[model samples]
Target: MMFEPTIWIGAILMGLSLGLLGSGGSILTVPLLVYIAHEPEKAAIAESLLIVGIVALTGSITQFLKRLVDFRLVVVFGLPSMLAAYFGAYLSQYVGAQVQMLIFASVMVLASGFMLRPISALPNSNNTPNSINSRVDDFTVLQYLLLIIAGIAVGTLAGLIGVGGGFLIVPALLFIAKATMRKAIATSLFIIAMQSFAGFMKYTYLQSTQELSLNVPLIILVTVCAVFGVLLGGKVVNKLPQARLKQVFGGALIPLSAFILYNNV
Candidate 1:
């Protein structure tokens, strides 16, 4: 395949969004693959899972090193998410591509709503924009169970739509786990990595059985560009006005989601 600058540029931007805004940025991946790279719909979704998973894993590693990640939460939330994500991928083959795009677009709209809401509207989080709050309380039995269920729900969406579900994941971690904003964000990255890989694996299987093959080299290129963006984003994450950034991102997503819906439906 010929080199595509659009895809690479989009990948970098996607990474920057994630690095700057957290997981919400990954919602851009499927659209980038489908519209810019011109991959088949199923292939784009699969490729998205792989690309997002790799980037999430890279971010998770850094968060882990900073002692920001909570492994206890990762195991509790990540496991169910991974399994549900696999099932979501497997289910996707039975659904039509147009329907999948519709679902993906709708999810983007929902994600934008999440972004548009005031941060205070969600669960109370002990956090400031700049500092990492790694402290977490022991979960109640009910909290653990709710987290497992939330994981399944988010993972299913992640697998089916090729989104990391970070917009949903961070909120769930905050509300259900009563985790701080920083910890929720950090833990959400780890969960996204695991579930995305699981979703990717199922899509890989579908590549053989359903004949929707992935562009491995393109995936690699996109991942590299995105990671570079993440690094760049990391350098400036604290400098930006996060609330305003989120508002801009949320507003931008509305029209983009509409365009996607228009094209698909």
Candidate 2:
């Protein structure tokens, strides 16, 4: 089996970021696969969905057992996202790889801006974590519409750009659905997994028809390393400052995005 320590290290950090902050893994995964592991951009994008989907699903399970998931929002937000992601992946075949990279890099820049914001700032002051959780059944027509629209936007980006779109999902849940940070983060993971697998399935169809290839062994190795890193990060999450971690990760993305833009343009 081909092995690269640098790639494994990136995987560990990608997973660690996810475990510590509940997001940011996708930003690392796609770059690591494409540049370090040297996978084709399209194939790397598809593989990233598989890797992140597995990790995000695993992370979401703990929140599930803790009863933190809002199933009503999951149905309203997740189902449409999944279908949209599938369609987005199908549409990807028409776009050039360089154009896709440009889109992904642009998204990374946007995601970094969101990460730099304070956690409480994501939701309005009136919608603090201490704010009482409201039933989805009580949501206004506009709120329901917001949830559905947010889901579709995040899902399309996930399929087109290979991002899990958790950065987008969490904020939408906080602002539109008024979910507390903890609940939004957990729910975001579940939605991302659904969107990712939907996109991956569509990509798999391309593999057969377009002569694209996925490096399954590389994907497996990266997934295993990332999961291990998640476990390690979980043990230290309480010891670390999540805000600082997000800031560092956000700052790091700036240069990485610049590098991608340089190459793509």
* Residue lDDT tens for model 1, 1-265: 3377788788998888777766687999999988888899989999999999988888777778877788878888889999999999999988999999999999999999988987776664447553333233456778878989999999999999899999888888777776767677778888999999999998888887888887888889999999988777767876977677777888889999999999997
**Alpha-carbon error at 116 in model 2, in Å?**
1.0
lDDT of 2 at 133: 69
Pick out the ten consecutive residues of candidate 2 with the lowest summed lDDT.
123-132
Candidate 1's C-alpha runs over 4 A off are 124-137
| Model 1, residue pairs in steric clash | none
**Per-residue alpha-carbon lDDT of model 2 for 1-265, expressed as tens digits?**
2477898899999878776766787778889998999899999999999998888787778778878778888999999999999988998899888999999999999989988887656664243545546689989999999899989988998998799988788888888988876777778878888999999999998888767899989999999998887667756776987777778888899999999999999
RMSD of each: 2.4, 1.9
Model 2 whole-model lDDT (C-alpha atoms): 0.85
Clashing pairs in 2: none
**Any runs in candidate 2 off by more than 4 Å, and if so which?**
124-132
What local lDDT score does residue 75 receive in model 2, on the 0 to 100 scale? 98
